[model samples]
Target: MLTITDLSLQRGGVWLLQAVSLTVQPGQRVAIVGANGAGKSSLFQLLLGQLTPEQGSVALPGGCRIAHMAQEVKASDRSARDFVLDGDLDLRRMEAELADAEARGDDHAQARIHGELDIHEAWSASRRAETLLRGLGFSDYDIGRPVSAFSGGWRIRLNLAQALMRPSDLLLLDEPTNHLDLDACLWLENWLRRYPGTLLFISHDRDFMDRGATHLVHFDQQKLELYTGNYTAFEGQRSERLAQQQAGFERQQARIAEIQRFIDRFKAKATKARQAQSRVKALERMERIAPAHIDSPFSFEFPLSEKVSNPLLSIRNGQAGHGTAPILTGINLTLLPGSRIGLLGPNGAGKSTLMDGLRGEKTLLAGDRTCGEHLAIGYFAQHQLESLDLDASPFLHLQRLSPKASEQSIRNFLGGFDFHGDEALSAIRSFSGGEKARVALAIIAWQRPNLLLLDEPTNHLDLEMRQALTMALQNFEGAIVVVSHDRHLLRNTVDEFWLVNDGRVQEYEGDLEDYERWLADRRKDDTEAPRNNQVTSNGVPAEASAGEGVGESADDRKARKRAEAALRQKLSPYRKRQTGLEKEMDGLQQTLQTLEADLANPALYDADGQARLKELLGKQAEAKSRMEDIEAEWLEVSETVESLEAELAG
Candidate 1:
């Protein structure tokens, strides 16, 4: 379905791909894997025609349609469902033509357009769009919300939904699960498993690729090679290939040594001289196989804390949430020196709230929360990426942390995290998401904290970095609590599972496969009892319809109607505030992003840009402060709405 021949590409004067060629057959799911900046995304761009190769040809089967998700989505005022439905360009175009035909009284053209619309399934577009949204963890109410009303991560979800809604012969997704919770990721995996099209995606999640991809493409050494299985299988093949290459290299070196020995012992001899000269020429012409390069770019471990406490942190009868409302209650948890717990729950199920409660970012609404004197915290959250100083380099960030530490020691330490040489001293404003995440982890590792709270830490990490992080976590001598969609990380690093759901936290006794079964059973129960307090996280109904399905006896149905009406009446104000706050936050964040982008430019440091720079910096600070306030208000309103809704259901 897709073919590339003799592909050569360059970016910013650097060669990315040279003489690369690959073919993807129809109905095959291919995963492109590589280290950061190894041109995985560049390959996608080339396939999408956004980038023109220096010398190559890319061909797709004639008339084949393509669908892809953009890495960055701009803020927009369009409703989420409508934005997704717009992916079906044919449906929208046919509707427009049909309207024109009707206005001109052209019955024949109108009929033709109607047939096209039917073929496009235009009538069901909205339903399909909404289903995609719901499966991606958007609440039913969120379907009609404006695109600008969601955060950046949620906007990324909208982009994924949009791509999934489009009918195509091929689909390309880049890090599709980066922002998704595990529940949403699972739904996506199931959806892709049933997708009747060629699939190619860039994913850093090992377990996701293992479950979804049927083929692997590794971008390495300025070449692209195809393998015949999932990520794990690819690893096996790669390991064997490297072993063979190493064996060849060793054998060639031994042969060369033999040739050299013959040359040294038999040189200047009338008979042996001819043979020695031939051996030298043969050695010169022989192609050398490069040794297998298996070292990870990252190698760092969390330093042990200065002091240890048996139970570093404790919370009893804790009601945790923002403001006066509680999102999670009856929370009794204790963190010990060796605790390694992974938080598992559906989206909006208080996993992040638990992290915040543990981090003391959110105060307890009721009950007691305590900490040991040596309970140092190293919390890593997505928001911290934005909180980083764009003007400061990694070296400066660390230097600010520990002014007493020698620069050489710090640089050596940073080198382990792959921020070497100028990269260590360079501004981080233009760093990719993975680079920024590494910097955050580097700071946390340097802190030597006894307790760690990490939320979605692997969102933008690559596979190698994630493995390094897993190893680091395994060797750490601290209590760790993490909320991540990367199942591989959770399985390899964490020792216990804490399931947070239905406003409570409990220990789950099974592995990830068991959690999947639990989710499936919970979904079945939610379908049977749609309005119960035990809500299915993604709002999935029994059917794939956009709206709720009716399922109750006449008396029970009437009671539900009455209760829904009352709940709606009470929630009306909070919902309104919720929308308003979301819009306000989006606008503020957009403004902040613009300012940050402007501040990131090197020219902003010059004399001419100083005036403008100063103005933007001031505005940036104001926008950020307002963003925080709006977020706090939004959290309060959302918590109130959720609590009231749960109460109504109960």
Candidate 2:
């Protein structure tokens, strides 16, 4: 069991949590719910002994292994599978011992180690890690891809997979679904349900919390309160408590008002002066109950489109993809003024591809797409967050959309989205993912677009913001096409779902419940027919009769060798150029590091040291310049190499 006893945490001379005490039994799923900066993360740190609590103690069973998802992922060249496999420390240790035993020619020790590994079931660690990767929406090919090859969101998923690979007694997950697509979220829900360890996680997705957690711990008024049930039940309980508190506040206000009236009426009279003073004292001594603050910080709505065309956009027999590949073939879709559709599919099944096609950002491989002349688009994607001007304020971004709008009006509108005062005027370079997401959405809404193409718009948004968005969308008159993993948002906003599967898109007749059932049936079919022609998790043929650790036939081997030789012959120059660029960058980086070390010395500012400092700075600039050039060359070469490699592999 995990126990926190009268724990108090203070940061920056303020109490984030006070007199907080909670206990979580083993094998229990406890969700920590709170507003941002309410010390939920601080509590996790306290449990991990990363921070010393100002008061009380945290206790976990001795010898317990704890695992947590990392918020930041460093770029690396290591394969994704290897990174995930590295999480199993015990397996690695055993393997190391086995190698040592072999080197020492100790057959008995080697045999014993092998037996231990067998007992621990370490032999299938690679396969198990791969299984986890597949469940998390990684293709078999992606598992072998280098970490540097993935985007920030995908890298976060890699970190999650690594954490999940660990053998643990306690698991701590913080916003695990922030980067996940709908399919990945569904798979993760199933995975966490099967997790045997005690789980403590922080999430803003209410549905995910209700499904994943058995207990809810809410942070309010510098205090932690444990509730008996999931998030929904906690909300009900909290609402009732707030109602009672509001009643007490009203009574206190009324009593204070009565005392004030009496004091005002009697304080001027000679005989009642002393009595009035007593009444004043009583009013001052009265303990007050503060009213409940139930209103959400975020409250904004999309303005109705200027011209609501009968058909905002329409596509017929569309084939959408890049190059010669058709991700969504023979797709026919139409969006009218009130059209509201949610996209559902596994990752890489081309929901984003479909969105791009609809946005007119990508050229359709076949068929025609037509839109009304008055159609206006507001498109949102994770990548668009990157394209935001780091130096521009949210106010400026909105102004760019509607230059004629008054600054005060724009500021007032942005305040509803919680970008207040200096935050609204400051550059967004340092903003968090959620903040940037808000800015992007705000820009979209400012346009008053007739058609919205939202691809995973809820990625970094919190619960209140999500609720606000749901409400806004409910009232929106524009044609909406949104793809999100937040089921609550989907249930509340979208009226229909389009299932993208096997290079085709079609309307799914049923709701989310039926979709879940469909997934279950498909999974069952996958298990029963592991080698079907249909796409499975692996997307690879199941070679059942080929025996354990099957090898290719002689003819297959010869053909593979020929193909590899031909590809190498074709790609030799690009590979060599990449190698050359890497060497140059390595040397330049070393020189830069040496120069930076010299610049770090405090004495470099002295008059005598100024000359050497100037020289070193000059050299540093030169090295940096050279390094930039090398990096550009490397990027070109690397891209070329990757293109060739992909073609070869395909």
lDDT of 1: 0.79
Model 2 residue 615 distance off true place after TM-score fit, in angstroms? 53
In model 1, what lDDT does residue 217 have? Answer: 95
CA lDDT, every model vs. true structure? 0.79, 0.78
Tens-place lDDT per residue, model 1, 310-410, is 78999999998877779899999899887888999988888988888887765567777789988899999999999999999999999999999999999
Backbone clash numbers for all candidates listed: 0, 0
Record all residue pairs in model 2 with backbone atoms less than 3 Å apart, i.e. clashing: none
For 384-498, candidate 2 gives per-residue lDDT tens digits of: 9999999999999988878999989999999989999999999999998899999999998888888888888888787778867876776677788999888877765565689
